[model samples]
Target chain A: MINAPSPTQSPSTTVPGRLETRGASRSAATLAFAWRTALRIKYVPEQLVDVVAVPLVFTVMFTYLLGGALAGSPSSYLHSLLPGTLVMTLVLLTTFTGTGLRSDLSSGVHDRFQSLPVWRPAPLVGALVGDLGRYLLASSIVFGLGLAMGFRPDGGVGGALAALGLVLVFAHALSWVWIVVGISVRNVSAVNAINIGVQLPLTMASNVFVDPATMPGWLRPIIENNPISFVVTATRGLMHGEAQLSEVLWVLAIAGALLVVFVPLSLYKYRTHRS
Target chain B: MTHPVIHSQGLKKRYGNHKALDGLNLEVPSGGVYALLGPNGAGKTTAVRVLSTLVPPDGGAAHVLGYDLVRDAHTVRSKIALTGQYASVDIDLTGQENLVLIGRLLGLGRAGARRRATEVLERFSLTDAAARQVRTYSGGMRRRLDLAASLIKPPQLLFLDEPTTGLDPRSRIELWTLVRQLVSDGTSVLLTTQYLDEADQLADRIGVLNSGRMVADGTADELKASVGGGSLQVRLLDHEQRDTAAQLLGSQLKAQPHLPPDPAVVEIPVIGSEAANDALTQLHHAGIDIISFSLGQPTLDEVFLSLTGHPTATEELA
Candidate 1:
């Protein structure tokens, strides 16, 4: 075993000065943590199977399985189905963020981060930022595969890009909901359970796969007014060159409101929550 | 007298109805290792957490590196690093990445962080595994990397909570050597351990904690001396003669012999070398055939048992 120190070694008792310029800024360090988290998908490719394979499988299955019944033909349905599937797939991927955060919290990594001198919110903020990549990846896969399966947007490239931007912004804001759940929940499995409970109902109840006009009179209002419905409607409007300023604004307003409430709520829980 | 590197008085914390830490006081002078030896659930980890600013204490006051733990927590955080009982480095990141991340968080610039990562990796003999993910590392390598991560800036003080809890003997010794080097270079370490030998081997001063209180604090020798000096242990060849041996030694040494769970062994405390010799001579003069007799200094185990009336939880489990 290691023993006493040798006499030749000098005891350097000088304390270094406070590092004024040496440390990275809070935002920069947080981004670095986020980047590292996203980069971990490279080592564990199974993480990507959800973003890559799920969107393709769901879009193909739903587009073919329900296309004739929901619309006149598969080609006509693709126009609406592709945009709706994009929103649904991106929303589903947000749950992984909660599961990842819960895992980190339970594994004692949070304790290490808590004891560090860095700003307390960096880990949570960085995690949200890192998950942006997953959201983007899922979006591209759904869109790219839609193009391959003979679906074309009436909206030009710019309109399609705009729609993608809106969905991403909405998904980004919606992530705070999961982030809050991630921090407050007891475990990863619990976070997954709660997120699925919230996500599945929102996706199914919205106008994702079918037009609300064909639904029962009582269900039309709930489906048409669902937040997911607003996003899917706005995205379809933009992608079909039928964009409306009010629908886009409504989506933005909801995204902004989710951000306003849940960001602070998640931050508050991040600061106070302990295991 | 120089101010202690760490000082706490009447520190208190409770979890619901159970007291995790109860009016505990501690002092550790600068430039050496101070080992807090206690059993599981004795509040050693709680004390470390409170001092390291991971958890706030419900009552009392503490100063670490001359800064108040609560009010001046930022200053204390800047001056200290903690390696928790678990290897807290990111498993997904490479060992080098873990160090660089900590370095950058500690305010080392990008280039500076890289340089420090390289240097600490070399110091811990982890250069070979620096590029590998920590998830692939053995327990010892991960621990070394964990310690290395905490040293990114070499704080004035470090908190090592059970640094060698599950390490193999060689790795344990290597960590001890590294700690000794760190202490020699003027770093103050507040280490908590259930292993008595670890404290005896590293601590310049040892503090015995039981039920969230410091029951004794002194150098190893002083604590041993307080427990009535060294002991003479005699083992009889025949189990039938054990009672006769205990009685004979009890009378010869004028002290009650302590019988551990084993029946063939008798342990008597002796004042000095002469008394030890007297006991051995008296045993030899008797008709009992001795299988073995040895004069030895009281180990911290005995000191711990004498002070607490029971072995540490780890020892009990062992």
Candidate 2:
């Protein structure tokens, strides 16, 4: 308060003098917004309800309900279903990124962030960074439950860790598609509905819950070509210690393609979106 | 005169053919409240958005705080702050965290941001609730936090887009007091409000907007004169004496007396305080007992009807 500039000097100087001689670095601003997201989760622990509960429910329900019929035994089904459900949980969590963003856009908070002098994309990028942590949480929950249910990986801890890394990269890239949806959509429910419409087909119709081999001929190609199925195949390979470089490269290409296309579209919509 | 803090020519913006801002021009001098008054959908928020560099104009040019709006937008953004219509503070974060976030973004160090946040929370009387999430705070508290965020660095120019739109009368007055203090410290402010009384009370000059263009602009009194003038309303003690009272008041005020459906009330436009005073005294002298009297400034509805030939919407603008 003591060093505050007097009123007479304001108009002449134009720019209001500040205590901080330099602006915050782009990384610092991004981290600051990430801190905001963390604080939000801390205050409203209920926001993490779906992250924790959904994964637990899916892991238990699928392993017990249809595991015996699908794989000829409940325990054996855990071997196949664990990796698939892990992909399903995290990849589906990416949809929430759009729903969160859509609400932020309408909350008037987005306008304030946009008006800031910091790096322009910091807020959106910061939110994406926070979503990475959420995906990590969901991954650990599914993996932790499977380990407790007598599910063991052939590749041991190293293979499981690699699988987790692949899921994160893929889920992180997929969030951009939802970020565009969040920014361009008019309301929150629309983002939610779109998430369900997109998620149901990808999670159910793909090779996540069962092998595409037993499917009718026409359905097999769709499941095999599905990107989620590619991610699942990549995940199963990593966890079982038999990962093919071509499969790894394919998953990388799909993730890279999503980042290349939707990242620009999301940022553009964020910058120019009309109220 | 010193260079105006804001000067723009033909500022145009269109939202899918709605023409939110259609070739509008504006100039606001530094160091006082300059209000933009208009009906809903009259481009008030759009103008604030464009000037604050949140949204780009489709055409036209603007200079804010002596920097070009489009070419030097980053410089302009550094010099200005905006408190949007919705209290833009993060509700899930505590008041302390919200202030710290804004301070850190504005370039303050960790310790410096915490210290500044403490001072700001105290100044805004939120120190007790600083640890609570903003969602727990009442509407007034949220708005105060929003304004506090805007003043984190004492920006050279502050844009307040309908700051007190939904606040109660007491809260509105409290916010007004805060704004007055900021102006006294010499922070130039450009505010928009749908209430004419708000503009009249706070603004040194006003621009009345209609359908994206500024239809009239000047001091409050000049605006009143442009729409004829303020009005004098008298509630009669006896409804039967209304005719005689109107005759006496008309002869004294020299304006046509407009008798509304209320038989006991007579309303007429008043140009000056002296004439209104004379009319009041004339009623007293004639022994026409008056139940109550009020000198009413022109409302936004009246202003719009006179300037644009239609009444403004009763709903919130901006």
In DockQ terms, which candidate is top? 2
**Model 1, span B181-253: residue lDDT tens:** 7887778899999999899999999999988889999999999988977888888888688788888888988
Residue B317 shift from truth in candidate 2, angstroms: 12
lDDT of 1 by residue, A1-275 (tens): 12223432222323244344334579877976786677676667676675457656766887788777778778898988888888888888788778878887886666776777777778877887888888787777787889899888899898889999999899889888988888888899898787567787788789988889999999999999899999999999998889899999999999999999998898877766654
TM-score of each: 0.87, 0.89
Q: For model 2 chain B, give the 10-residue run with minimal summed lDDT.
A: B309-318
lDDT scores for all predictions?
0.82, 0.83
Clashing pairs in 1: A2-B177, A22-B107, A23-B107
Model 2 scores a C-alpha lDDT of 0.83
- The worst-scoring run of ten residues by lDDT in candidate 2 chain A lies at A7-16
